[model samples]
Target: MTLEGWIVIGVIFLCLVFLVGTTISIDLVLFAGLAVVFILGIIPAEQALSGFSNEGMLTVAALYIVAAGLKETGAIHYIVKRVMGNARTVKKAQLRIMSPVMVMSAFLNNTPIVASFIPALERWSRISNIPVSKILIPLSYAAILGGTCTLIGTSTNLIINGLMIEEASIRSLGIFEPALVGIPCAIAGFIYLFIFGDKLLPVRGSSMDTFQDPREYTIEMIVAEGNTLSGKTIEDAGLRNLPGLFLIEIQRNERAIPAPGPYEKLREDDRLIFTGIVDSIIDLQQISGLKPATNQVFKLNAPRNERMMIEAVVSRSNPLTGRTIKEGNFRDRYDAVVLAVSRSGERIDQKIGDITLKSGDVLLLEAHPNFVQKYRNSSDFFLVSSIEDSSPVTYDKAWIAGLSLIAMVVLAATGILSMLQAAIVAGFLLLVTKSFQYSSALESVDWRVLIAIASALGLGSALQYTGAAEYLAVNLLEFAGDNPTMALASTYLATWLLTEMITNNAAAVLVFPIALSLSQSLGLNFIPFAMIMIVAASSSFSTPIGYQTNLMVYGPGGYRFTDFIKIGLPLNLIVATIAVSLVPYFWNF
Candidate 1:
């Protein structure tokens, strides 16, 4: 090994040590390592910074906009609601997410599938009271397992297949050739996760879990006619298990059903009274079939989609302080409808129109985004602030977002466009069609995840450019001696280690020629070696940086570096054992 190779290895090792031992951010840790390699003259400036322009990295960025479009239009909610289907337990939720994801991943690119699911699953986790950490890892793993089943399932499979086609002597793989071993590995993975996931996955809670809002407000919503929630029971409608919110009663045309049972059916125009904190109220506003009972919300000047939720504290000097909301012409006077009011952490029992505004009472208002600017310094209130992500969902444009996603998938799958191109088109469609705002699209992207991915790619480039990856693979393969089976195992181990250390595609590319050389020298068929290489490269469990999907979920799942090692290392071993044992049987050595 050269001096540069040794330095690259040492830098990567130190990065891993810091990642496992400290709470520092993954992006910072990885970029720091890349910087070390670049500064040491091991890799040039262009090679070190190449990851920022990587197709895979930019594809992830574009996909974030696509996912954000789906989320902002409330299109993802329909998919999540159907897929999750009222799963009550952590195990059930995992099953619901993993089963279909695995199947879908078999035919589609797993990256976008995992991308679309991350936000939806986070929302689902909050609603279901299941920790996000428990399901995200399963989601990523399921996608990876499924990707190994078919030719188009993952890029790694196609990369190896492309290499095979390039060689005149080597036979190309069939569409389902990998499935022979892939299916058994997938089944093993499913069994392992189903049986032990609940215990093995961490139970880290989101920020919303720790903070309990002291101020509770009573709000009323009407079931819109012909909406999805109408004619469904309370439980079936998903209104029964809302966190920090409770259904106090359902007001029918003439009668009131207090503490409505879970099985009680909701009729159109049924006024459902809920007592909850501001967060849950915001959640309720997003539901497609539910609308604030106050007609004043519709009387606002700005379009519903353009408005936002604001909190205003009433001042003694305000003219409407002593008057009932309806009597004070609140909507006409302030151009904002009071959704709910909180008085000293107590719930107001009166209807929104009937509540008498008092000094120091906090008001949750729905109005144009400028409401804060207009009244923040005015004597009309004490403090005024707009809530983040509180805009009304653009439900009307949901189909546009949904169709754009479908188009992206079809275009990418059929080779009409590359994944990056398809994602770019989809994101563009979303912006032009107003399905998602450009500002929200920009905000929706997790810059940290993108930076981390690019940094990891840069590190992978350093390994390849420094010849560190090749040196390590050669040293490891030399131990196989004259045994073909031992050589195959060594190749798999080498590729797997490289994958954990760098990007899977880079690992496969670096190991491909070496494995081929070994096969030629041993006077054996290269088919088995190729098959093992495909599986080893794609089986990037054990570390978050090993796979794109794993990194996609790292921050969202609130996982540490050790979290991947603890659960994924075992899965890696299981899949590796299965792949090695079955590859030679399926393809002759």
Candidate 2:
């Protein structure tokens, strides 16, 4: 190996440990490393930064906006209602609910698709007295399967496509490219989840919690003197500022203080309760110069009468974002109270006092049932009302969004409009039609996913431009050495391993460049390699950490680590075998 090869290997190793060993945000870490590579001349600056403008990155961003539009308009929830309507039995509900969900995921962003169905699945499980564990895992798995069905089904597909076109100018990847292998794999996966989901998966709350939520760690802590504004009320103490402190209880000496006053003095022995985000407690302790009482970055709602949690999606065109909830009169103008907010699986625990409203932040509103209905079908927000009703469509306006989206899709597919432009235009039109609010759509776009995609794409570009990808491929081929099938298997297995440790999109971005090189060297077609990369990325079936959809259901499903192992391990292996076998056939290699 050359000196550069050793350096590259070291970088990859450190990246691995940093990602898996610590909670340092993976997106920032990878991108920072990519920047370092450019500074070191490991990658040309153009190649290193070109990924920022990659078509796949834009597609991912645009798709989020479009999905946000659907979510904002109550369209996704509308689909869920239609799917689960009159479904009585757990078995029937799973088939009716999960089957369609998997199918929908094939066409949409898999994460949103899974998230969109969560409430409906939970409701159905509760109504049928079925264990949510019986359904949620399958719900997640189906979405993963659906993701494999088309090029746009998952960001991994688009991302890998972007990498290939950039790396080698491969045109074989465009236009319904993935359906050849993806459709069959999705079909097989759907059947597999249907047959084994219940038996293999545990029921929700089958363990410690009443829900299938993960094992939450509970810790104790006390406040320290000399902290900034120690004499300030708890409200001013910035207890809310402390990350990972999900307040559970407050202790005074030996007695527990349930709800201490914000103005209460920080007695030497006062303890605060907290829940998630525990990792950041130490940082809070250091920054605030507060002694780490057993409780960590310790950190709810107004009175039951005044505080309320309403789940509402920001309209795609909402202008309320970048402004505090107070500015919009969220409580007054909306006739509802914001009790809690959930965004892309993470909860915003801050007091709704003055937090800015973002689109796609599922505002859990606390309000009267009467007012909740009024919020439903409103263009400004999506009211997640349990009471179902057929919306009186402004037929003209509805078609405007529908036709615009279709035209965008058609234009892109036919090569009239670049996919990036198509999505951008679609997002804008949704706003003009008031199908969703523009400001809301922009605010609601999952910025985290966007960052992750951009960063990973940059990393992929670095690896390729620096010859890291080709070097990795040559090494693999030296071992597999002329065995095309083994070469395929090696890349698939390697991608799967990385996914088990990092984001699936990141995994795809890392592996696609190598897989592309492998295909070219072996004189094999690129489609099979592309197929393997796509399927492998989606095959994060083994652990909750492997996929966000899995993690979202982790706590809610109350599943143990072993729970995923028992159910997902087998599914992972099965899909792996089927994907590898089908890819070669589809690509005729």
Candidate 3:
């Protein structure tokens, strides 16, 4: 390898280190690495930036807008409620969730499919007495498997198809070409889930279970010394019907008022004790004059009202992981006050000040609304989400959004419009019909995912431009000399491992050139290799980091990292076997 190739390799290794070893955002990491390579003259500026203009990347972004329209119009809720009706048992529930998801993901993008299903399935899990953990991972894996079954199922598929058209001068893949291998893998994957999911997946409680917590906490909130509530009754102060929280007692002038009634008057320095889920207790922090009993909260520079609520999930790589909330000076560092903390559906006791933070600990915070937008891409949190409901559904436009989606699918499937054209048109129709505002649609797009895909494409270009992919391909072929079956298996396994380590689209882009080079060197058809890349890249099941959908469900399901390993690893092997066995027979070596 030349100096440029070695430099590229070093950059790729750093990306892996920063990604797996830290809580940093993948998009930032990729872009930084891509930028470094660009500065080094490994690839020209146009090549480095070409991925931003790639048809496949744009399609993914447009589809996100369309999915947002569907979600913001209540169309997604209507369809899920109708299809996932009354599945009482876990087995039956999995079947219901997986069946429709697979069918939808075959045509629609899987990211939004899994995102829309999460909240609905959580509610379903509550009513049906089924654990969400058992079903959420399977839901993600099912969508991934389904995405392999069609040309437009995932951006990765389209990306690979585009590369084939460009590099090999091959005809664009027919819409169903992948299904020859994808269908068998999907079937095998579904059966593996049905048989082993219950046994392998954890039985952790869903977020709904948090409401049933019987533990009471003596949460103290001091009515600030100069508060308006000092002269108002409990009802007058809007203390009634505080969901899941009860004002059981109050202390004023060092005297306790037990079972305070709605008509009870309040006074300054009154310490309030409420018992409820941490989610609700955190809501109390939003009240302007009602400050946490801990004096530490008042030390923040921002007033309570100026501060908004954000939920930050701590990752292992967070620098504050081992420190207590007070010890860490969390508020001073992030300009956010920790209002409440939860771990695996259980609330940390009222002395949250003393509790140590750990990976996966969710902190309900009081900060500026932009706090979420600011730290959302930071490495300190595994996931940063706003507590506010900014995008409520416009129910009046539900039917319009639904009809638009159906039309987009029909038009694209019938070849009246290309997939990209259909997606763009559907997104425009969504904006025109008022399903969502232009700002809302733009916000709905997960820009990080797009940036990551685009940056990864640039890296892939570097690999090809440097002759690195061809060099790697020649060596990969040495192991499978004179054996097409071995070459196919090796390529599939390589793609699967790459997918496990990085985003699927990036994996497909980085590996396509090598797969093509290997097949050409061996005097074999490239169709089988291309089909294998589709199946292998899409079948990312061993780790949460392997796919976007899996990470989306991670916190809600209360799942540990190992939960994915136990369940997804087996399913990964099963799907890989099915793909390797079938791709050759269908595509012919």
Winning candidate number (lDDT) = 1
lDDT of 3 by residue, 1-589 (tens): 7889778878987886776567676678889999999998888999899878876667767877887777667677667657765555678778888888888889886765675667556644554457899889889989998999999898788889999899889889999888888888888888888877788888897545656654333356889777667988887665655656778789887678988999898888888877665545644553546777767655767543334566788998888899988888887888877766667755454466787998988776766677888888899998998854323232567888888888887777676887679888988998886667676677767687678777876776776677665456456546776689999888887777767655577678877877787788889999888998898888778766567677667666877656777788888788878888888888888
Model 1 alpha-carbon miss at residue 346, Å: 3.0
How much is the lDDT of residue 542 in candidate 1? 92
Number of the top-ranking candidate, with TM-score as the measure = 1
- Count residue pairs with overlapping backbones in model 1: 0
> At residue 202, what lDDT does model 2 achieve?
74
Candidate 1 lDDT, tens digit per residue, 1-589?
7898889889989999999999999999999998988887888899999999999999999999999888888889779889999899988988999999999999999999999989878877777778999999999999999999998898888888899879625778899998998899999999999988999888885636744766788889999988888889999998999888899999997789999999999999999999888877877887779988998998889777778899999999999988999999999999999999888867676789999999999999999877888999999899999988788785899899899999999999999999999999999999998776677889889999999999888988888887888889999999999998899999999999999888889888888999889989998889898889888998888999989999999999999999999999999999989988999898887
For model 1, name the residue pairs that clash: none
Q: What TM-score does each of the candidates earn?
A: 0.97, 0.51, 0.60
How many clashes does each candidate structure show, in the order listed?
Answer: 0, 40, 1
Off by over 4 Å in 3: 39-41, 87-93, 107-137, 150-180, 195-387, 390-394, 494-531, 542-569, 584-589
Query: What is the alpha-carbon RMSD of candidate 1 to the true structure?
Result: 1.6
Against the reference, the lDDT scores of all candidates come to: 0.89, 0.61, 0.75
